[model samples]
Target: MRIAVGEDDVLLREGVTRVLLGAGLDVVASTGDATKLLAMTLAFRPDVVVVDVRMPPHHGDDGLRTAIEVRKRLPATGVVLLTQYCEPEFAIDLIGDRPQGVGYLLKERVGDVDDFAAAVKRVAHGGSALDPEVVTRMLRPRTVPSELADLTDRERSVLACMAEGLSNRGIARALLISEAAVEKHVTATFRKLGLAQLTDGHRRVQAVLRYLAAQGP
Candidate 1:
């Protein structure tokens, strides 16, 4: 797959490029500036773009802005955002318009080449890839809706697993329950949490984010 990178750190840009190249993916362009990165993406039309959270000229959200721009300008291009810190607000914003072909991963997690490569591929194939840490922070105990508060402890566990990006089968394996049971719990949890009306995957992510945000820091 063709990919572009936008990271202010020289070493990190090189490391990520090397990893992608080693995985037999083409690194079309790599840049430390968000503006140039956007330009490169428009010109190259890569399959995916991996970006850092911070970049030059307003480092805080430059990379993030570029990601959003990609969503608008190059709807077909996937985006993978790597951040040194987990910012739920940024994650929520980046995921606002589309959850498919989107990912938010912790920079520290890049040490695992296999996982990093998998995340890239997942986003490229129109799937979500959120850092486990991001999910944990987003799902911590909070004053959930009264309806959600009614879930049994086991059901809550199922919901938590879903927030952590686990598939029904993965949740089943992790909780030592049958996949069928996991699906049942998920359906029940959704109904109780009033998330049953949300059918879009992106909206579902936002629903979970809103629930978590209401629960507080």
Candidate 2:
């Protein structure tokens, strides 16, 4: 898959490029400026664009804003916003219109080369790969009669993992539980959240976003 990277840190940018290249993915473009990222996206039309949430000048959400614009201008291109924070608000907004081909992952996750490569591939193929912390932070009680309140702790764990765009096996590995247990929790979570009708590979992502969005900004 082809990928474009946008990050202000030159070292990190090169590191990301090397990582993706090492994973056997093509690095079509790389830039330190968020604006350049959008420009490259329009120019290269990469399969996926891995962008840092902050870039150039003020270094606060320039990449995120660009990602949103890219989504609007090039709906077919996949976007993955990398960040140091577990900022779910930006993520929720990224998928406000739709979740296909969008991802939100913590910067630290790059250490796991295999996982990071898989995430990029997933987004390229019209899927998601959210950071687990993003969901956990999003689930904190902030409203009464919340949709998330209906879930048990384990179910919530399953939902959090799902929000990160992990498969049942991935969730099991992360949580150190059996795949059967993870599947059960996923089914139960979906049923409780009324997501049964939307059952599909992306259903968990949709349901998690529904719950997170319900909490409002």
**Could you tell me which residue pairs clash in candidate 1?**
none
The segments of candidate 2 whose C-alpha lies over 4 angstroms from its true place after superposition are 144-217
| TM-scores for every candidate against the unseen true structure | 0.65, 0.65
**Highest lDDT scorer:** 2
lDDT of 1: 0.82
lDDT of 2 by residue, 126-159 (tens): 9999888887877777544377888876677677
The lDDT per prediction is 0.82, 0.83
lDDT tens digits, residue span 1-217, model 1: 9999999999989999999999889999999999999999999999999998778765556788899899888988999999886866567777886788999999877688988998998899999899988888777875555545788666776767777888888886666456777888877767776778888575458546755664567
